[model samples]
Target: MNRTTRLQQITVTLLSAGLLTLSGWGAAASPVQAAAASVAAPACGTGDHGLLQDLQKAHSGADSIPLSFSDVEFLNTNIGRAAGNGFLIGTSDGGCHFQKIYEGQWSFQQIDFPDNVHGWALAAVKDGQAKYLLRTADGGSTWTRLSNQAVTFERVEFLDSSQGFGYNRASTYYTKDGGESWSLIKTPANTRGAAFTSRSNGWAVVIVPGSGYRVMKTTDGGAAWKQVLKSSTSDPIYGQISANDSQVYALLYGDSGMSQTSYSLYGSSNSGGSWTRVIAQETAGGGPAPGSGAAVAKKGPASGTPGNMVLIGKTTAFLAGYQPAAEEVGVGLTKNNGRTWSNQKAVPGFEGVISFTDHNRGWLAARDLNSSTLYVTKDAGATWTARFSFETAGR
Candidate 1:
């Protein structure tokens, strides 16, 4: 374990017990910095640590970050997960340019695409009733509006090459041909997330009016649905969804009070038939073994896919590998029923939002405050590889 984690444990121990050995918040840590243990270089492709060091020195303590389709998919897993081998790792050789800022349209928040080369980006207008969903192909060089009219879109989820799900005003929209076409489904409110074990068997978690959150299961690929679990307690947040072919985890967060909230994570073992509550506070390490009881250890093939990710709270962590203690910030880890997170590392440049494809496979798609380029580490946090140097970077 690194010194940061050790100090964090001491900190949490004191705080949770309602006792303080110190008198200031100077010891507080962000999860982004604490989760990562190292700062190694990126693997594969064409980037290096020396390059990153050169850029870091050039900027005098700034950060740079990047993202392709896969990176975006991982960060947006609340609505989706990896379909196969790697994230949609397709991009033009040069670079993709974000659309120009519209006066009150096209902000690039909601995104959906049927095929690899074409997609849509939705943004709520700054002071208008109409929102924009910018469509792109040829590697994001430019975008165009899909419609002149604006509707109540809150979140967007693409199911496949020709189908997807989107939400507005707590109602679900089903598309047989991407966002080009859409149909309304009977959702009670905005859906927290949607996932599928097989192409035909999928599940969703939605906010029910006056009753917190609930789960929806569909055996025929969401053609129809059934309610499995509904919380009598708190509602689900918008960004806590994860699943593989066999299992899924739907995470929800809402505090009843300042001091009475648990980590509040839930898992679905038998597809979506039942749901089990996991943690209420931040937990770390990998996720659980498939079909294994809490009393037994499971050895399924997918467990190695970084089982559960790790989490970083305001303070306290328990891992190691790279970087310095002071550069620490936020954290990103699994929140399942286990304690051995794999890619438990601090995402360079970005803070607070982190997601992994599996234990060893993770990525950060957020931008840095100092630069516009992207940083990546294939070996967790041991090192970093800088892409696009000699340009604007970020924090």
Candidate 2:
């Protein structure tokens, strides 16, 4: 998602979830005040062993300032997950430019067709509201416009350099020869999010009108899809899915005001053919009393809400979120697939979005003083180092 659209979604979600109070057209709480109360001290782990000191000694400090994408509204979705080789892509200035992070170094370059770039996918595919599609083969060094006619896509994903898919409310499009050619695929339902494990294996969360959310699977590329699971309640369930070689994991959240404001984690080893509830934890204001037949007790404040979740391995994952009532931001991890969780030490900032490329390397996007900063961690969720700061970059 583009930074602007993602921020708008966050504002709307926060308002709906009662995390932010709105008086007229303004927020009652300032970003700085909220951030001041939310930051948590780092929880350095056993292997930490002066990793921060080592980083300082090796790089002399984190990457220098004047970083790309530091001027515009920043969102956690701005940074893409790290590829197998540790190639990471991020947007700057709302997708007008690109930021490449490789080998612990950061570099920036402008997109060839910079107008209205709303979303991007791996293997360098860029699309936007203007119906334009562009691709870059040699990283961001050069870009090629791929579409002659107009097309609108809200999300795009590429499993590899040769295959990709893009979609919106109206239609789904796919390409095999990189982004050079495109074709249409019939969608099972209106999809909110989509991810592919391979060229022919993928999953999508479909909004089934008044029914609820349905997890769909596709094995013949995009030619067909089958419903793997349908929510049992009328309450809306928003889901984010991640997949590895043999299993698919879904982190789900119900409606904001439901009596039981709990979140669920489900895993399927057979490509969404069947699912097992891995973890279900009640939120602060909803569900049964702790240890009174509940599987997992609430850990954060009474009004804490769930945020982004990433599965780095079959049995390991991380979740980031905050408790608006207490102005506390927290991160948690589940080593045994979510059956049990341990809250990491607080890190003193509103955790917005988190992305993990592997078991121990990840990045977090946080908001403070109405600006965004990026933090990187090489030791799981232990110690984090500030990699990019908007304020410092601007100076």
Best prediction by lDDT:
2
TM-score of each: 0.52, 0.57
The deviation in Å at residue 52 for candidate 2 is 19
Tell me the tens digit of each residue's lDDT in model 1 across 1-395: 00011111101112232221221112343454334312331222553324335434433443322221212333211112111101122211111111111112233444444333445556544334466655554323355666777756765555544555565534556777656767655433466666543446656767754556667777775567888766644333442445544355555544423222222445554555565554333212322211112421222111111112223221212122121222222233333433422233344342222333333333334334443333444444344444333333333
lDDT of 2 by residue, 221-300 (tens): 77888888765445544566767665676655654443335666566655576666655566445552111223443553
Candidate 2 clashing pairs, residues 3+ apart or interchain: 39-348, 39-349, 40-346, 40-347, 40-348
* Number of colliding residue pairs in each model: 65, 5
Off by over 4 Å in 1: 1-106, 110-115, 123-130, 188-201, 206-212, 220-224, 230-240, 256-263, 273-278, 282-343, 347-359, 367-373, 380-395
What's model 2's TM-score? 0.57
